[model samples]
Structure formats: C-alpha cells, structure tokens
Target: MAFPRSTCLLLLLASFLLTPLEGHTFNVMDYGAIGNGRTDDSEAFMKAWSDVCKASASPTFLVPGDRRFLINPVVFEGRCRSKKIKFKVDGTITAPSEPSKWKCINKQCHSWISFKHVDGLVISGSGTIDGNAEKWWKQGRVTGARPNALVVARSNNVQLHDLSFKDNPHMHVVFHHCDGVKISHISIDAPEDSPNTDGIHLKETASVIIEHCTIGTGDDCISLVDGSTHIDMRHIKCGPGHGISIGSLGKFGLSETVEYIHVKDAQFTGTTNGVRIKTWQGGRGHARNMIFEKIRSSDSEYPIIIDQFYCDHTECHDKPNAVEIRNISYIDVKGTSKKETAVKIACSDTVPCRDIFIQNINLIYDQSGKQASAYCKNVINGYYHGVVRPNISCLQNDKLP
Candidate 1:
C-alpha cells in the first residue's frame, strides 16, 4: 500500500485537465496585407473565424498563400461545442463580383461558405474558391438570379478538400440538413451553355461521400435535393452537364425517400443523360435501393435515364397514383455515344417505371447526333437490350422516336 506522492500528484492533475487538444490554426496572410485583392478582408476574416473558432486547440483555419480574398454570407460566429472551425485554404478565396459586395445586415445573405449549428467542420485546401462567375452568369441571363456555392446547414461532421470551383453563379455546391458529409479532390466548372449551373447539390442530406469530383454544368450533375439518404458516389467526372440525378421533385409535398446509393467509377461527357431519375407529377415518395457501377458515357442522352413524369417547369398538374420505383441497378456501363440514342426510360400514367436492371452495358448512340427516346407511362420491368437510332423507330418525348 504505497500511495501518496501528494496523492500521485493529484491523479496527474486530473488527467491533464480532461484531455482535449489539437484545434486551432489561424493565418489570414498573417493578419496583415489583409488578403489584398480589394479587401474588406471580411472583418479580418471574421476576426479569424472568431479567434480560432473558440480556441482550446491545434488544427484548422489556415487559408494560406497568394491570397485574393473577398467574401459574404459570413456568420461563422463561434460556440460549436467542439471540433472547431477548420478552413485550410492555401490561397484564392475570391467571391465578390458584387452580389452587391455580399450585402447583408438583414438582407439575409449567407453562403460563400456557410454552416449552421456547426459540427467538426474541416474545409481542406489545395486552395481555390473562385466564383468569379462571369459577372453573375451575365446577370443570370437577364436576371433569373441564380445562387448557391458551398452552403451547409444544420451542420454535422463536414469535410471538403483539394478544391477548385469556377464560374459558379449557382448550385456549385450545397448540402442542407446535413449529416456526415465528405467531398473530395474537387474540380468544378460551368458553361455547357451555362444556365442554372449545378454540380453537387444534395438538399436535406444524410450520410454522404462524393469522391474525386469533376463536373461541368448547366444543370443536374448531382441534383437530388429533397431528403437524401446514405449516398456514395465515386470517381465521378460527369459531363459537359446534367446527369446523375434523382429528382426534380414536385412542389412541397416533400416526403422524399432515396435509398442506399453506390455509383462507381463514373465518366460521362457532353451529357444530358446517363443514370438519371426524375420525379414530379404530384410527387409523394419512394426512390429505392440504387446502384450504378462502372458507368461511362459520351455525347450522352438516354445513357440511362428514369423519369417519373418529371416536368422541368410547369406541366405536371398532379398525376401520380402508381408511383414508386424500386431496386434499380446498372452494371458495366461503358461510354462513347453522341451521334445519339443510347438509353432512356420515362415513366408515369400510373407510375410505370418499376424494378429495373441493366447488365454488362456498352452503349454508343448517334444516328444524327443527339438521341434519347422514351415516354413509357407506368413503366413495368425491363432487361433492356441496346442499339437504336439507325433509321430510328422509337428513341419518345423531350423528342426522337
């Protein structure tokens, strides 16, 4: 019974005061030259993100190097319980092509990087957040007003890395109702005839992990905004734009139920199609167990699509009765099309698209550059066999047949 060296130094000082270190790295150009590039320096980078995101730390917040800063939507106020704000951008944070210099103070602006009720946030860097956005997409082509780039609400354990975004007036990135999120080695772009440039927009998110990204857009290079679920998309390099979708949900009847997803080794170019899922027409719920592997396509259209009566805008005056797609699968999806006609599936009239699967795929379409046809109302089952468009016969609406 040999105790007492001052009671073992008071139990080693109570385990070093309840062990918790590593969280704090701040350096906005060493707090000077204030990130030049026409600086407001966003109140000295929100006072170094409220001083090391509530110090007690050693990791996160080092937007280093050749700076060119300007930001808005900057309400990164602290008290995140822990995990601390970690933004390690090594240069280039440009985002003020005058959205009225990010006006706020009750105009309710937020997002050039945002987070609500934060969690262990860690935005990585190979540096570049440039939303120069070609004069706000030329004023959204006469003031349509597009907007969205790096927004994470109702936060969770979020992590972004090796960044690079270009010309984004809208939907370059957004994850609302966030859960465990992780996006990697990014490279995004716009101008596939830029309209509503989308590339990674997962609203009402759950568990997500989008990897090795590269998207170019006008729309839907990842638009599943409506109560998402555990998603895992890999090696994606989607298109000139639009593909990899699962929605276009109707109004606010929002009951979205997308299932466990796994899209692998992807690649699509000039894409208007290739693994798509659209829903509207009095939308209720249900998008089941999904899986698309080894996907590859070019000059796409019907590269693999599913439309549950998705009517882009206006024209879906509520028409769902038998809606509910199930266990979907596409394997060995290979590319090289664009003379047109590869694969397209459309459904409704009582929700036609049902349990489907495509195997050992190889699609190459082009009978006259741009092929896609399908208008199957209440689509049932299919083992789909390819090749159409050589003196076309039935390639259906949105048109070619």
Candidate 2:
C-alpha cells in the first residue's frame, strides 16, 4: 500500500489529536524557577500555577525537595478548570529578608503566598515556609505593611496538613471567607515577642476543623473573628502566646456574630490568657453556643475571661452598646493562673451575659500564694459546680441588680 505524503501527514496528526490527555505534574524548575534560595522564582510559580489551573484532569504542582525557593509576594488566584488540584511543597519557600524590598502598599499585598477562590485544593508538604522575620522585628513596629506567610481567602474544601511555618512577620495562616477547611498535623513557631504574630486566624469562615496542631506565637494561638461559625479545635498545644480567643470582634462597631464554637482537649503553657472572649464596648451582635472544655493550662493568666469592655488604649472610652454573649460553658478547666484573679466575667451593663455555666474549674495562682478569685458583673443565670475558686457568690441565685 502506497500512501501520499500529505495523506500520511494528515493521518498522523489525527492520531495525535485523538489521544487522551493525561494528568501532568508541573514542576516549577521546568518553568525557569531556579531553586537557589536567592533568585526570584515568582514568575515561574505564576506560570506553573497557570498551567496547572487549566488542567482538565487533576494535576499536581510540585516544588521539588532539597531546594530553596525565594518567592516574593504572589497570589495563586483561580476559577480553576480542574475540579481538584494538589500542591506538593517538598522544598523550602523563603521570603525576602528586607522589608523595603517587599514594596507592599496595602493590606492585600501583605501576604507572601495567597490562594483565592480555589476549591478542592489540597496543600500538604513536609517542607517549610520560612518568613525570615528577624530583620522586620528589629524595626520595632508591627505594621500592616509586613507580609504574612500564607493566606487562603474565598476558598472552599481546602485541606492543609503536615506543613511548617516559622518566624512569620504577621499571622502565620489566615482563612478568610473560606468554607469547609480542615487543617491538621501542622506546626507554627514564632518568637513570643514577635508582635501580632498570631498562629491561625479565621474571619468570615465556616465549618473549619483544626486539630493535632502545635502553635507557639506572639499573639492569639487561634482567633475566631466575626461571621465565623461551627469551628471545632481539638488536641492543640499552645505556648507563649495569647491563648485561644474569640471576638476581638465588632471593633468598628458593626453588627457581627460568632456562634457554635467548640474547643476541647487543648493545653496552654505560659500563655497570657485561656479561652477568652473579648469585644469592644460599642458593638452589636452576639457570641453564643460556645464551649471550652478539658483545657489544661500552666502559668496562664485570666484562665477564663469575658471582657465586653475590651479597650487596648488609654484614649478609648466606655460605650453603651455591647455584644450579647449567652449559652457559654467552660468545663473541666484546671490551670495555674499567674494572676490572683483567675476568672473575670466583666460583661456589659446594658446587654449583660446570660446562661453562663462553669463546672469543675480549679485555678490557683502559682507565685502569689494567694487564692485565685472570681469577679463578675452584669451576668445572670450563672451556675457553678465542683470546686469553683473565689466562690461565685455574686452570680448566686440568678441575682441581677
């Protein structure tokens, strides 16, 4: 059989086009990204993400092991074609040490790596995201101009595990407006004096579960802000930071609500506070149906505190409206408090906290040798059980004056 050259070429092209498209692994090194730790690999990363984002099948974007990648501020934004994508970071990702080089003009630019509008994204790696923050810390001012190591915003069905973040300039990881996020087996470390270096911060997010994580940072180990709901945290070890907190919320005097939060089986060592809920004096909304149980604290201050009048500066004055807090419970919380007053429930006089329950709580001051005490005001329907310190006499008999 003799075939003409043009006909043979057409048949070959048809055969190639009919072949099935296979999944690919886009390596950053293949796209002109030198993993020498000094060269800027931002463009390579962007190109890799673009290729993987358009993959028809589930593909992997890999950062190979044993190499260090220096990436400036980059955003991996997507309405990706793939239904699922895997990002395997097997090497170190380092940020620029100099703050001036960051050139961050606004808050959005203050993130080293950001993922937006990504769905079904799995980020797991045995690698490190190093935010060489010692130089920024020396500048001595915690500003929004500094970049956070990672930010996952407007994303859904995200799972991040087995990763490490160190020396972050700001909060290590932030989940903003994200849903169905699960994070486990992660480690975050920062100096105790690294200002505003919160470990994990959630805002406007829902259905998040964070477990089996060890976090040590300067600010709150875990902070849930406005519009966050159904958050569960378990088996977390926190140290040298402000402990788990909710509702440093409504700061702008806006209407905000945080509900259905449960934090159990957690331990805090040398933290400033444990299981705290703080809100500004003039705010609207509610913090309800929250539980903190089986918490073991060591050398912590204000082991259980609800401050409706949370003003950080001297110029802030008391306001009338406050966030309504109700149906909150703290059970089996035993700790050594650094302050003499272990329990302070300073609720708002206007709205007042209701349906508060405390059980099996035993907090003792370590150094003072004085017994820990409880202070309550403008609270009602309070119940105490099993060795309550400082005597919840003020809250006895549902008394409201």
Candidate 3:
C-alpha cells in the first residue's frame, strides 16, 4: 500500500479544491455586545459590522433574537468585499432613551442608524427597531433637529423587508441618493400626534418599488421629494397620517424635478389627505407624467388635491415663479370625505396645471350629512372622464398661456 509522495500531495490538493467554504456569521454578541437593553452596544455592533464587511464570502451580521441591544448613532460603511451582505436583525435594536445619551456633532444627529455606500445590501428580519424617542417628542419643537430612525444613502440594489419600526423621533425610514431599492412587508408606526414622523421618505432616489406596507404616522405615509423618479407603489395601507404626498418641493427657491411616478391600489383611512401634490412658489422645474389610480379613502380630508400654493409657514411671501405641474392623471378614486371639499385643485395663477385628468371619481361627505364638492382654481386644459362626482365646473378647456 505504498503510494508516491507526489500522488498523495495531488490527492490532497484535489480534495481542497472540491470543498465548499461555509458562509460566515458575525454575531454582535460574539464581539462583546451586551444584549441587555441598558448597555451601550454601539462599539460591539461596529466591530461586528467591520468583520462582516471584510469577509470575502457571503457573510451575515446577525443581531440574534430574544434580547434588546442599545446602540447609539452609528454608520455602517460600505464598499464591502462581498456584495451579498445580509444585516439580519432578529433581536430588537433600540436607540438611547434620553437625549443626554445620544451622540451628536454640534448638537445635531440627523439619523440614528445610517447605512452608507452599501450596495447589494439586504436588511430583513422579524425584529423591531425602537427609536425610544418619547423624551424628544415631548420637547414639542418643530424643526429639522430630530433624528430619523434609519437612513440608507448613496447605495444601490438595497432590499428591506419584514421589519418593524416603531416610535421613531422623526421619519422612520429614509432612502436618499440611492437607486434600485425595494421595500415590502414592512410595518412603520408612531403616535398620530408625533411630529414629522413620516413612514418612508425618499429623496434623490430612483427605480424604487414599495409594496404591501402598513404605515400609520403623524406625517405622510410616504413622501417623495426632489429628484425622485420612476417610483412605483402598490397595496399600501395608510392611516392616521398625512396621506401620501409628492412635494413640499421647490422650497427655498430651489429648482426640482420629479417625473414618472405611479401609485396604485392604496387604502387610506382617517388621513389628512389622500393623494396630494404640493409645491412652493418662487421655484423652478416641473412634476409631470404621474398617475394615481385605484385609491380608496375613508373619512379623509381632501381626497384629491394639487396645491401649488403650499405654504406651511405663517408668513410666506408670494413670488411670481412656481413649479410647473403637468400631465397628471387620477383614475378610479372612490372615497368618503370628511371635509366638504373632496377634490381641490388650487394651482398657481401664473403657472396653471395643464393636461390634468380626473376619471371615475366617486367621493361623498357622509360624516356631517353634507354634500361633497369640487374646487378648482387657476387650472386650465383639464379633462373629466366617466362619472366624476360633484362636477368640476371650473375646468376651462381654453388654452391660455
């Protein structure tokens, strides 16, 4: 049974080549993370993420279940060795309950947890992300000072689903300056009186898809601001919030453009507004080629509206310039309105809305036993198709520049 030394070496090499390497799991607990809710596990999380990013094969950064990890503000850096990196949060990740424990630079921390430059990232699990923002909300200051829960910026091909985000100080999840994003089966919630708690906010992002989400918050369930295009949303349930909005854009006299947006099969209940598009004066650019279809609203105020004169402040100086809105269509919108004006299209007098189409709309004011009506101002070249209730009498087909 004597074999040559070269033959034995060759056999060993073949065995090594055929064997598969198992994927790594970098658990935060293994990196000195205290699973207790009070301990600061920020450094342990960063350490775990560092190893996960440096791993050559598919690796998972796991926050296992049955424990609460208190982590402060941290950013997970990207450009990882493996593109298919998984951030599996099976346990709860909580923010510092008090402002004193929060780490801020110059008294400002914009986001609690941020993911930057991470491409092909997948964040999924049945765990909760608790902002622990009760003290912050009690301050009752309405400024851009509060920190959002989770933010993913400058990334591509990101997927987030099966997560629960609750009681965030401000917006729950924000995707900024990203492309090819998918969010589904996620739950976001906060108290109705919580200020600026938007469910999902997108800015400077494109090629996004949001579906099968249940969101109830103080602000818009989903808001798409400047430079967002090619967005598709469907099967969403929004309530106790400002209904899905597309704007507050062109603020600060900035030029912004949003186009090719589609929202379908959304259900809104007890929301402030159903489908809204608002813009500020003294700004340039246009919002065009948008479609809102198959929306059902119940006891909502302003089921369909387009306010180019959207001024949130008390003293907003009126300017001559305005954001142009064109080629917007609303189809099959059936709703029960809480207010008398079910559909309000208050466009700018200078730059009127063009090619605005409303079709198959049936909205009624069943709350106060009054009639629901339509209000339109500075709107031109509008078209009304099949069964538009409350009859938009102000629509003028005359082309005026």
Candidate 4:
C-alpha cells in the first residue's frame, strides 16, 4: 500500500549495483609507520604503497606482527590499481646496519627491497627480511657493492610464501623480469662466510616454481642466471651454500640463455658445489634442457659440477667460445664428497657437452673409506645409465667428437 517514489528509488539502485567491493587494507601503521627497530620506515613504506597501489579491490599491504621496520632503499612501485596485490609480511624488515647506513637507489647499491611493475603479487607472512649485513661483510669483497635482498622487477604472477631471510648484503631473493613466479615456504640464512649470499636468484625469470625452500647461503643455494626459463625446484634444503647453480652465464661475452631447468628433492649439507654449471671463458649462448634429480649430498664439494672454465679470477684468459652445454641430466644423485673429484664435467673446449646424462650416481669419500671420483674435461656427448658410482669414465664412450 505504499510503493511509488520512483519505485523506492529503483529498489535502492539495485541494491548498490550488486554489492561486493570492500578489500583495501593498506596499513603500515596507518601510513606513518613507526615500527621502530631504529625508525626510518621508508616514508611509511612509500605511503603504504600509495594506498596499496591505488586499490581497486583486492588490496591489503599490511605489515603488522611483532614490529621491527627500518627499511631504507625501498621501491615498491607498480602499474597497479590492484589485480590482486597482497604483500602482508607479518613484521621484521631491517637493513642498513652501517655500510655508511646504506642508501643509493639511483647511484646503484641495487636492491634492498624493490618490487617494481608488480602484477598479481602476493608475498606472504610470518615475516623476517633482516640483512643487517654485518657492516656489509666487513666492507671489502671487491669493496662490497652490496644490496640485494628482495628485488622482483617487471613482475607478473608473483607469489612468495612464508618468508624469512637474514644477514644478506647481496643476493637473497631476486627475480628479475619475472613471469608466473611462485616461491614456497621460503627460509634463507646467511653466514657460512657470507660474501655474495645468494639464496634464491633468477634473472629474466619465467614460469618459476620453487618449493619448500630452506637455503643456507654464502652464494647460490639456487641461482639461475641469464634469461632463466621454465624452472621448477623441489623440496630444497641446501647448506653452507653454493649448490644449485646454472651459469655464471655468458659473462663478459654476453649472449646468454638458460633453459628448462628442473631440480628435484634437493638436500645438500656442507655444500660448496653439488649441482653446478658455471660458464665463463668468452661466453656464447645456450644452457639446454636441464634436470638434476633427487639429489642429496652431504659434505659436498663439487659433488657434480660442470664448469665451462668458470675462472673466478687469476686474470681468466683462455677464451674460445663456451656456454653451449646441451640436454643435461643427472638423476638420483646420492653423495658425501668433501672432494675426491666426485663428478666434475668441465665441458666447453670449444663448446662440447651434448646430451650428457648420468644415472643413479653414488659418490663417496667423506673420509672413513675414501672413494669418489669422476672428472671429465670438455665432455663430448656423454651418457651413462644405471648405477654410476665413481664410474663416469668420460661418460662411458658415447663419443661424439
């Protein structure tokens, strides 16, 4: 008996255009952020990431939990308006423990928390990003150029999980040119003589999916340089790091490229190199389809390397076109080698190393009964199947020049 009045304002504008529109947290202590671990919350996290990147719904940028901010070289910019931006971080994100209180940005000191051009980003909670890098590692590892602790540039579908990284003044979480990334259960620690502390690095990233990580760094617990491709790592737990590398790629000679990499169920203890692939000498391109399966190496030290003459110094000269390694595989790698060789395929005497595959390798020699060996130079098309224990004999005669 009382309808009219423009039919009750057209039923309240169709119930406010079918509801659903509230999700824009943006709390960095309400934009003035005084989480206190020595103050500088970087302009309250860039004004709460500018209202969580201008929120258009799926927003959230919080940083709550047991406080400890103090960030300095920040950057969090993005072409956002929210396509799912959640960066929660339960709290603790230090850095700037002196190397002159570190702050460079344009004059370089590269990354101390940068996530530019984000897309569908989602960094998880139970945080801890620390990097109070012990005075930049006593300042002098080539003058400690420092600063790399979280940098996800040109992002795509990124998603990092349950974070925790520490004492890193160099590489600890870097994913450049990202696309479809997903890092899981993260945990990285430094100080095994922390210098380049790389825990999880990847350049020109694509379709990445790292899982259950637990890295202990001093370098590469997982590094895939140059245009990294479809990478997939599993249950990793590397140690005093250096295991898991794929190219010190095409360095002074550029033209690099890394291919579909897959590492499985990894676990390396005192690592120094357990599954490597360091390229150097006048680089060219191509690090083909790779896979290092079910690896478990304790007391590692070159438990299976493929150094394309990766000279870290001594005025590296000998250049003759390297970086062409082909379809590589090393399945079920079991080990305990503090070095008695333990499989070192130093390929590239003019780009050698084609199909190189080795099956169930069991390396020994961690003292108690010495026995572990296998070293091949310029690997020329190798392939050995089934039980290969200290017996790679140049990959068993699959010779191809």
Instruction: Work out the TM-score per prediction.
Output: 0.34, 0.92, 0.93, 0.36
Q: Model 4 clash tally?
A: 0
- Of 2 and 3, the candidate ranking higher by TM-score: 3
| Deviation from native of the Cα of residue 318 in model 4, angstroms | 41
Per-model RMSD to reference? 17.4, 4.1, 3.5, 16.8
Output the better candidate (1/3) by lDDT.
Answer: 3
Q: Candidate 2: list runs displaced more than 4 Å.
A: 1-23, 103-108, 140-144, 367-370, 397-401
Which candidate comes out best when scored by TM-score? 3
Top model by lDDT, which number? 3
Give stretches of model 4 more than 4 Å off.
1-25, 39-57, 62-85, 88-92, 95-121, 124-128, 131-158, 161-192, 195-216, 223-241, 245-271, 274-342, 345-394, 399-401
- How well is each residue in 300-364 modelled by candidate 2, as lDDT tens digits? 98888999988877887878988999999988988788888888999988999999988778888
**The CA-based lDDT of model 2 is what?**
0.88
lDDT of 4 by residue, 1-401 (tens): 99999999999998866643448588899888899799788888998888778767788888998999988888888898768889988999897688677667776787888988989999999989998888788775666477888999988998999989999788989988888999999899998888888899899989999999999988888999999999999998999888889979988898899999999989899988888988897889989999989898988988788888887777888888887989898888886889888788878767788888888788897856677888786666678877788887777734434
What are the per-residue Cα lDDT tens digits for candidate 1 across 65-142? 777787665666445546656778878887778766665546644356666677778777887777777777666646
**Local distance difference test scores for all models:** 0.71, 0.88, 0.91, 0.86
Q: What TM-score does model 2 achieve against the real structure?
A: 0.92
Clashes of each: 17, 0, 0, 0
